[model samples]
Target: MTIKRITFLQELLGLFGLQERVHLAWISSAEAQKFVEVVTAFTEKIKSLGPNPLPAYRDAPRAALAAAAH
Candidate 1:
């Protein structure tokens, strides 16, 4: 289940050209400060990038829900 979620998000990011364009971080509970710093940077970088390209995923409705249901 964990593997699938990561793979799906990675693919989704790649589809939107944000895979390499953005940085992904998974900060632990003890790393709140690091989390804030990385999240702030990520938001600023994404803001500068303008719009998202994979908005079509919503067109399929429960596409993600279905994927996770498996």
Candidate 2:
């Protein structure tokens, strides 16, 4: 149910001309440096993209995300 709820919100946000999305999770018990490296790479990937790739999706107003959510 939580996953469904978040998916819905992500889709809703996507509809607002900000569809860029990535999801990451970590267990607090894990190593700190491991977390750092992964997030660093994620940041780099986001930086490379500059901003939203699904500019068209935004125009469609989260319709894609809604389909995906289901």
Candidate 3:
């Protein structure tokens, strides 16, 4: 079930070129170290990718409108 959800999200994100931003991991509460490692690695990956472009892209129309109103 989790795999299915992850797969669906990956596909959906792929449509916007953000598939790499989605990660699925199974970590138990006892594995604190593993959780930290996974989070650190994912954080580094996201940093390497820089900020997400979708926000800017999504707001472009609004920005244009605001500029035009000025």
Candidate 4:
């Protein structure tokens, strides 16, 4: 069940081209160093990927205004 939730999140993020940007990790409280390493690696990965390409929500003011009219 836990894995299913993780997979669902991965797939959902993939729809927005963000699968690589999201991750799930399990680190014990005693594993602080491991946590730091994981965070550093993920940070570098994101840096290399550059900026997000998804369109800004600000561009949808027309849609939002239409919905608010209802």
TM-score of 1: 0.47
C-alpha local distance difference test of each model? 0.72, 0.67, 0.89, 0.81
lDDT of 2 at 60: 74
Q: Per-candidate RMSD vs. true structure?
A: 9.3, 8.3, 5.7, 6.5
Give me the displacement of residue 46 in model 2, in angstroms. Answer: 0.9
Highest lDDT: give the candidate number.
3
Better of 1 and 4 by lDDT: 4
Worst window of 10 by summed lDDT in candidate 2: 18-27
- The segments of candidate 4 whose C-alpha lies over 4 angstroms from its true place after superposition are 55-70
1-70: candidate 1 lDDT, tens digit per residue: 6666776777888864676554556789999999999988888888887767456466755765576573
lDDT of 4 by residue, 3-54 (tens): 7888899899988678888777889999999999999999999999887645
Candidate order, lDDT descending: 3, 4, 1, 2
lDDT per residue for candidate 2 within 1-70, as digits (tens), equals 7667766777887786344455445536467887887788878877876866566566876767787673
Off by over 4 Å in 2: 1-5, 11-20, 52-70
* Poorest lDDT segment (10 consecutive residues) of candidate 1: 15-24
- Per-model TM against the reference: 0.47, 0.42, 0.76, 0.65
- Candidate 3, residues 1-70, lDDT tens digits: the string is 9999998999999987899999999999999999999999999999999998777757776764576473
On TM-score, the candidate that comes out on top is: 3
